[model samples]
Target: MSGRSAAARVDEADYIVVGAGSAGAALAARLTEDPDVTVLLLEAGAPDTALELHVPAAFSKLFRGPFDWNYDTVPQPALEDRTVYWPRGKTLGGSSSLNAMMWVRGFAADYDEWADAAGPAWSWEALVPYFRRVERTEDPADPTQGAAGAQPIEHQRDPRPQTAAFLDAAREAGHRVTAANLPAGQGFSRTMVSQHRGSRSSTADAYLRPANGRPNLRVVTGALVRRVTFEAGPDDPAVPRATGVYLEIDGITRHARARREVILCGGAVNTPQLLLLSGIGPAEHLGERGIRIVAHSPEVGEGLRDHLVAGLAPAARGGTLYAAEKPAELANYLLRRRGMLTSNVAEAYGFVRTAVADRIGMAADLPDIEIIFASAPYVGEGLVPLPAEGLTVGAILLRPRSRGTIRLASTDPRDKPLIDPGYLSDADGIDAETLRAGLAACEELIDTDAMRTVTTGGWIQPAGGEHMTPVERAELAMRRYSHTLYHPVGTARMGTDSSSVVDPALRVRGVSGLRVADASVMPNLIRGHTNAPAIVIGEVAADLLRGRSSSR
Candidate 1:
């Protein structure tokens, strides 16, 4: 093992990207295309070339293990005083490798809303080309869709029998099912996952690994960035420019200089926390904490948001749905990369608009809730102890009405930050209502001729002949099973306003030679999973840094 001291290598690079996760990998790969530019990517986690990472069925195993930065949230009020566990990947690919691999390009209007809130360049019309550039959609040249890029997007192979039955039930419930990514009408549809053949196509696999061999790119693992080092000129007291970063490795601290820019790709929580730790947040807050205030930006850690979902455990007709049951299926996966192991568990999905979207005149494209039909329920707590049998249908509220924040529990980077995602905090919060709609939709499936053959009974919480009304069931569901969609964003929002941390160009407010190119820059949460959009942000930011004029 070659352990180089950070102090010995205080060399400068054209760019220093913190957090070698999804956005960081893409940004590093794109920027290093120019052979003259030297790029250094620092990650707190190890690399992701393990065979376990390649096996699609082993995703859950990666959670809370060495690869994951397992952080627990404060007890959520809406979740019956339950502290939700957040498993973010701390490896080379970050959450992209550990995630369920659901490839969701958020609603078209979600980007349009960005444009409406921030600037014209962020609109769907502006960002679609970039989305297309980063992804190789499975169904290319379908007019409404196409795939011609690095990331491979495809439909699940050998979906479970229960998946097909669930779709049939959704159809019988009077919802429309379609093959499109952002399908029309309300109902269930198959999920389009981020997989090529059978392996997960993470940004690390698609972008970083290929670029790793380049001489100009240097990747340092297990390097935890502590704070941004600043230089204060005698004349300028308010604007202290960031020249480098203070990073810790194996209990030793060192500084790495950035000649051009220091990009923060540390996701929502860590990004804002980093800024605050570096004295770049609200003046009063930092001053009260006995820290010098460099930039008094109030929005550094405000406007935090995330997607919330309620999991519904349905009764299975027979034994468990573990992929290990089918030996031949496993053999096919190990041999030719084709089998049940290749399937992303949330095989079928549907997007529907609740009453809230109706009031807003949201189009069919703007789906608020995404219902995932899985072959089996992901039972057991904290990523361990698999259940012997059962099925799970997850109802995710894409456009959450509630907001939360991420603050420093202390200045120590080792200590987990305070994450408070105020789920179901809306009077018009669509979580409860949307979940009821999902339950109704699921019941519709149970009643269908196809599902009747498999489903033996109902397992709605507070079970049995109890006089619990639908409203009561919905509320109970919200309390019992509402977990994170793992899509946390908007803590360090980008806009042209004073409250914004970064501007439209992703330049951090009141700072030079620094930018943020990650999900944290989102002004609001996109109406779907965030991996695709985070990649798009990196792609677009690369173009901007390369001096390319905006086509939008």
Candidate 2:
């Protein structure tokens, strides 16, 4: 990937992918594998050259920093009217560069619902090949695991003793020990991270950077895509098609045309925001903002779903990952990329069905909540600094019932969009009740003999909830301490329904030569982390585009 001078410009390419993120990087690299297809990859942020980006334990340091798109949501009603902060990666690897790097595939039923919404092509069985195609696991002989793939995913090499205790506590609390990526298992396992030899394996490192030198691929950094440009031929005035992007490069506005298609890989938030900015969203919302609407698609920024977690942190008897912040650990990381520096913070996790699931009429087969056990206090959604040596047990609602919206604060491309996650605002109050149950479950796990062996103090954040009832304590803790798990999806959902922004093939419904290939197209929230599945989405999108391009 030769660096281009600020004055350099590419007038056109066979394909243009906006956002050189987890999905975009993979898509661009895969498309360029066909030497005939010239691809232009545009990234808003500068190159990811910082040392901390590759270090696993340093992920939280990037939050709200220069590399983060540091967005905040509208005040939520259920959580004491608190505004939540969201950290999205702005660099070449996107959020993959900034995220905890946990590799989770979600449940099989999650894709079954996707297939039901889209087609059989998105079924769990159908997506296995793409999953395998995107991941390189440690076990080559294992049929379920990938042997040789672009992304490196490995089991936690050296889990902290506290992590093992959490797993033991989970077992004592009635959950089973499960495989790393089992779709049906409602139990605990050490986290599988997107890393190789202990360092982060962001899509930039796994796919884009390795493939950047290819003659067919041109990567442009610090290019902020303002809007997608659509044009019509003189012969077909009514049928306007996506032509390229209007981008800002080093303070200069430039246009880059696409000969084939313009793909949006800007994830759930930015993709919808860009679509609205490009005049392709609901008519009334666009009109209200005094912006012209090219496509009156009502579902452009609707159906926003995300996972919200309430942290239950107990002071630990043993030392926490906070010790890794010292200079000696830095030396260890620099020398061998091992030790506490390799920790993803969220060291172990489990899926569990709480009693509230039956009350809320949730599916029995689907887990209602996820417990991510961090070796340190991951408070304030990893935004707040750790106060002391503690173990954090995060109770995450797997599938929220409430829906939210992403709206335009204004037409300005530089302005951040209005993000309203509508967290715990389900009319039926199911979301809140389910989360309350999850909190109770977390308390149960913490109170177990296994956890008691490692923990030192009582509830850290709730302050005085020790004497309160489990339900009351859960309610208090949830109301005062809940935050996003950073897994927002479904802003521009893909479905067969007319309300969907994209079709089953991921093409924008009202626009030709344009498609969304990221979390924004998810019809529903999945049951696990989004990183690995997002890479798979890119692989599937590349195949979909290639199939159509080949036919033509």
Candidate 3:
């Protein structure tokens, strides 16, 4: 509550970072490592004080709750005009606190693709050190996994027995059971989570908590940044220099001046929305909003991509997350910290190269689908709790060909943006085809003897089971069951080209003294979960500002 009763009329800092979630928390913490440096991290939501936030299996209970941004997409034509729920975290750790905690790093080629768009600085080899700097893997099976980093990356302490059955089903279904997050060809493995003991270890817990006592670092919660306040560039008046931000805290408007630079760590949705509100996006869009144009970056909110997951939940016999909140389980979790409550719903996952991607000659290393195993019925997009015990096998479209946009609905900063992921809107219908292949894979897993042993022959998701035709089943899954896996990227894409929103160094084009250090800057969405990469981005941004040169 530092911001609730502070007498900060005009707060000043060396670096002003907007949105103290995954990236901002780490960035502010790392920057303040130098005693001389000063940093101000602004978070719109309150602290991570929710009791449910500490419980891994209770993550879904936060969806659309106070801690979540509670965003929704514009009706998608391809999705039968369903307004898909897109829940983002509004609190200290941001989405990382609300996520399933899957620590998936994807493949080397994904970062190499980023290198192709930006520079060698973004290549997998170049980013490995940053990963090492951010992750402290408790169980490092591979030499590549980090051992001495800021965040705790540990395997799930108490994954469900049904989760193990799902992995066995993968093997029974003719899939290789290998370690997850492999640089190339990731196979089935229990998900490594961002946890410590049994509680969630978000960026707030990992970076901010450790740096709380730093005098030079100031963290202001419940601070909603309205726009970036700019001044005439030091060199030229035509170009604007980001001097600070205009933020609102508890209905009081305040100006926090940045002496050196302003960094946007607002993630994919908020970053572009802030830019457009500040007249830094497309000139036409700004004109329509009656906002003065500060920059003409047309691609600020374009190139939207996300991992879409459709789940098939079958009724289970017993021993699922359904009883996680039972009295006995609650007591066990509270006292021993060893129970279903410690389970990060999605306990196991793997990457699979679908026939659809192979037909298009996609890279062998870049899989088209990701299979996720959950111990509970993850239906209704985790918003509605099912009454019965069930197991979920989620099929994720890893590399979606379709593009989308994030645009302003109104000039008000509080109004949510129009999120149009345009899922399965490709001209050739390849995106839909790829998802169909993924659905078939999900069916294969559920049909296995190992899966059959755990799950009863009853279906919980789609009322109809094996009676529907393959094409009909896939159509049903795509139209009715698919939802976002919470990974959205490329809204403020960075690349070597001029049209890109930011350059290779993550500096915003057409503006100086401003940079973006979140998933919004990614030129392309990786094949894995975005949490690991997002934290690494903050670490890399810290090095970028500190002038710590990278060898790769």
- Please report the candidate that would top TM-score against the real structure: 3
Model 1, residue 12: what's the lDDT?
Answer: 72
Cα RMSD for candidates in order: 2.9, 2.1, 1.5
lDDT of each: 0.77, 0.86, 0.88
Considering lDDT, where higher is better, how would the candidates rank from best to worst? 3, 2, 1
User: Which lDDT value does model 1 have at 305?
Assistant: 84
Shift of residue 300 alpha carbon in model 2, Å? 0.4
lDDT of 2 at 382: 78
Residue 143 in model 1: lDDT: 43
* Model 2: number of backbone collisions: 0
Per-residue alpha-carbon lDDT of candidate 2 for residues 210-287, written as tens digits (9 for 90 to 100): 887788988888888999998873456665689999999888988999999999999999999999999899899999
Better of 1 and 2 by TM-score: 2
The C-alpha local distance difference test score for the whole of candidate 1 amounts to 0.77
Stretches of model 1 off by over 4 angstroms after superposition:
1-10, 144-146, 183-187, 233-237, 323-330, 359-365, 380-382, 427-431, 458-472, 549-552
Residue 60 CA displacement from its true place in model 3, Å = 0.7
Candidate 2, residue 284: lDDT: 93
